[model samples]
Target chain A: MNLSKKSKVFIYILLTAAAIYFLAPFAYMFFSTFKSEAEAIAYPPKFFPSQWHPENFIKAWTSQPFGTYLWNSILVTVLTTAGQVISCSLVAYGFARYEFKGKNILFMILLSTMMIPWDVTMIPQYMEFNLFGWINTLKPLIVPAWFGSAYYIFLMRQFLMGVPKDFEEAARIDGANAFQIYWKIFMPILKPSLILVGVLNMITVWNDYLGPLIFLQDRSKYTLALGLASFKGVHSTQIVPMLCITVVMIIPPIIIFIIAQKYIVEGTSGSIK
Target chain B: MNRKKFFRTATPYFFILPWVIGFLVFTIGPLIFSLIMSFFDWPLTADPKFIGLGNYIEMFTEDDQFRKSLVISLKYAAIFVPLNMIIALFLAMLITQPVRGVKVYRTIFYIPAVISGVAVSIIWGWILNSDYGILNYLLSLLGIEGPRWLVDPAWALMAVILASAFGVGTMMLIFYTDIKNISIDIYEAASLDGASVSKQFFSITLPMITPTILFNLITSIISSFQQVTLVMLLTGGGPLNSTYFYGLYTYNNAFKHHKMGYASANAWVMFIIILLLTALVFRSSSAWVFYETEAKNSGAKKKRKGGKEA
Candidate 1:
């Protein structure tokens, strides 16, 4: 619909107001990270920090065994991402390129699992982990991710299915084994999708609080999310550093989000079929 | 054994081996274990004594928290799903037009979607702070008294719900893309037919976007029921147990209360509700969801193509 000049001005104003309304919390949280506790809890809720104390972040970071938790989180995310990308690629290739027995039924089962919440399995899964004596370890958090997650597998499978059959046909004519064709031919073409999934998994694992909350029993074994959660619990009323820690926790994901979002929308959106 | 055939067959299994094991051990294994555990008097410390339907009976009859959680969860799902889908769709429609600096608005809308639930809960907790919060400051300006948000039993869950509605970024992004996909020619055609902008939106846009609406509704229902973290953080089920949601309750039973068998039963009941609800949505899609391609399809592949487009 066309609009008059006044209408356009009004639209612009409304949008700017909405932007600030939605974005104010982020700014508030960031500024709160720099203020003293008294100022943070002061009346009228100051829009800016009274002091520019970047050291609040350092205090928050050093407040916990955040270093170890950060390490654990990095390790877990890397392993899970590597596992999912490699394993899902192989499985997706199988679904896409090769035909086999019980394939459709298995795929349907895989898709159906997507709707199932992790809570349903909490008790039994906990029981099993208890049996394995893997409590407080990173094993439960990371190991299962190596298995092809159903959604990632489906996404990769869709991409693989789009690859031209002629490439494989030509590879066979050149005496290249299926392994060689999959590795040399399909894997490279699947790089962007793989990177996207891997990065997605990293963000997911990084942001996950429940997994660590459930599995890890000790403070030293915590991830960034779990550690920050505990830190928040301990220092809830302490305004500045807690907010600083909160900001620290999300910065990586936010930064990664800005970078990876371009690939996610375009790369995935392009493959409509 | 030829290497080519061996590689083809073996490689897929290798790729899926992790999932297969996880599915059996983690997914399917726990599923069966949970079922079995539901019938037993299990504690974390020792072997569960077989108690045959006792846990299930206790959940519905004796355990007040279990029943309360079920009600709260259902209420939460009922409210959360509609708000998320409606608000997100509205945001999508507003910013979907070909306007300058739309990307900035889109990015502003999308940022909160990617904000982790943990971060959001903490941020909202601070924002909803009773005395010094920005919310209260805004309310005081309007000469309205702001209730103590998280502390008050009556408003605690409602507060959490409102907090979530502010950041319906994921659904907003999904709907934005969905709206963008609608051909501009449809709008042109409707305009030529003397349809106003609102009329075209209701007729052309709403009907076209139902599939996404339906998808969001079902997914949000499932997620709302599963939203444990916010409650776990904000109220920890609260001062008077008014805001105790099902997920937090379930986690409490399994972890804190040492009622593994009981928790399993609760989870199973929740699963049944979700399954039945989702099945109902899929079941009724034919009646209300206007599948343009499905109306014309004489073959299955065309329908598959159509499904992927939405």
Candidate 2:
């Protein structure tokens, strides 16, 4: 795979161009957040504000109940991630380690569930949640993950299946019950995959808009994504504050992605193969 | 049955109970109920009345928006699926090259994907603003006029496409990983045979990555059809209903317009279309998608047949 200097230069040029395409919008938005409303939208748009107004972030935060929204986002993300990791692992371990009757059928059903578009079941889900009086609460968003999702379960099952059968036999011979072996032995071994599931779930729940948009009504119940979107609806002309909130909303997920880049890559490749 | 034997038999189900319960409560029950609701004339406030096939019939025969939204979604998928895949695969190949500081470039590309659709739409909105947008300003400096990206019906869909394509890095990473895992020896051997780099890519890398291509294709099709958030936030179905995506149409019907039964019908239509598309692609995949297991199995059969002949 050795390359000539010319080819290397060409590659760098192409890479730099693509990087700009991906990054230029964020860079523009980040800098524009500091600009005054008029300056931000001035013709021949400025790339850097003449006067850095870090106060825009503060203004945006207080303009809405963004602190409340941030807390709700964190609550949903943390709970869902914890729930998905634990529940998916248990379900995946069952499918991977046990030879129960109807296991193949049940597992097939789980896989097929991934293909069912949320649009189909969402109306009835809304109705059901309403009947339970769970609408306008975080329960609709957070409670379901406790039962496990098909994708995470499948992912965990893939990781677990790669473990040798003999890995668990030694523990069983020592009279460790199935639950004990799962909690004591497999949980530790599945740490990376658990982290993978947690990270994936965190990013999704943190940034989800439609789930909150549908079930929750009050601004108090709004997650960061829902809150940011609502902000846009209210103040369409206020670009600076909107951009500020957008920047604030994106920070946590970007930070999480940067920290967990390795697991994310490995998890994606794992799921495919 | 004895207690011990009963417990042993139930162990697996106990372990998997959470998902089974969830499937019944959250997935299957709602699925069945939504199907039933599709058959009725249910509204948000009023009591439901049985009107079997009424909603479906109205959708096909009467609802122009229904047809328009469907066409819009199809047109989007047609343009987007292939374009995004190419960009993703191309970027993937670029990043996988043996170059310095490629990691930084990869992170830069993927950072946009990690950002929420909400933020992405806002950023693009400001950048594509007709008067004050940075993009239009930049184009003006080049002695050109940028179309009102979000306003003009002619360009609204394209604007949506441009904004959505920012997240192509996820698919790029998928292709990158697949390409990275390929044995370097294959390319080296191809080089020994005097195959050009392009020739090696076509004969080796391309064929080797078909499985990943198929995976990306199917997933992207599913996702592109479900592309509600970007359009919902970015265009709000726009100046001329030009960008009223089917997902948005269905969401509006159910949540905004409060036609629960009609929306349920809309959703079922989308589901069937997706199922058919998936089935068609899967059937066609045998012609192009090269599976490692299939290759190995055929090789094994050949060796066995040769042994028998000997």
| Model 1, global lDDT | 0.82
Where's the lowest-lDDT run of ten residues in candidate 1 chain B? B8-17
- The lowest-lDDT stretch of 10 consecutive residues in candidate 1 chain A is A264-273
C-alpha lDDT (0 to 100) for residue B111 of candidate 2: 89
Per-model lDDT? 0.82, 0.93
Per-residue error (Å), model 1, residue B46: 2.3
Clashes of each: 2, 0
Please provide, for model 1 over A61-153, each residue's C-alpha lDDT reduced to its tens digit, 9 standing for 90 to 100. Answer: 887788898899889988988888887888788788877767788789888898887778877887788789888899988778777788888
Best by DockQ: 2
Which one wins on lDDT?
A: 2
lDDT for position A174 in model 2? 100
Best TM-score among the predictions, by candidate number: 2
As for candidate 1, its clashing pairs are: A147-B18, A147-B19
Write candidate 2's Cα lDDT for A197-258 as tens digits: 89888988988999999999998999999999999999998899999988888888899999
Residue lDDT tens for model 1, B1-310: 5986777667656655666777898788889888888898888888889999998888888888888888888888888888778888878877876668887787787777666678888888888989788898988999999999988888898888987887787788777777888888999888889998789889999999788778778878888889888788877888688878898898898899888888888888889989999999989987788776876665677779889998
Which digits, one per residue and each the tens of the lDDT, describe model 2 over residues B204-243?
A: 9899999999999999999999999999999999879999
10 residues in a row with least lDDT, candidate 2 chain B: B106-115
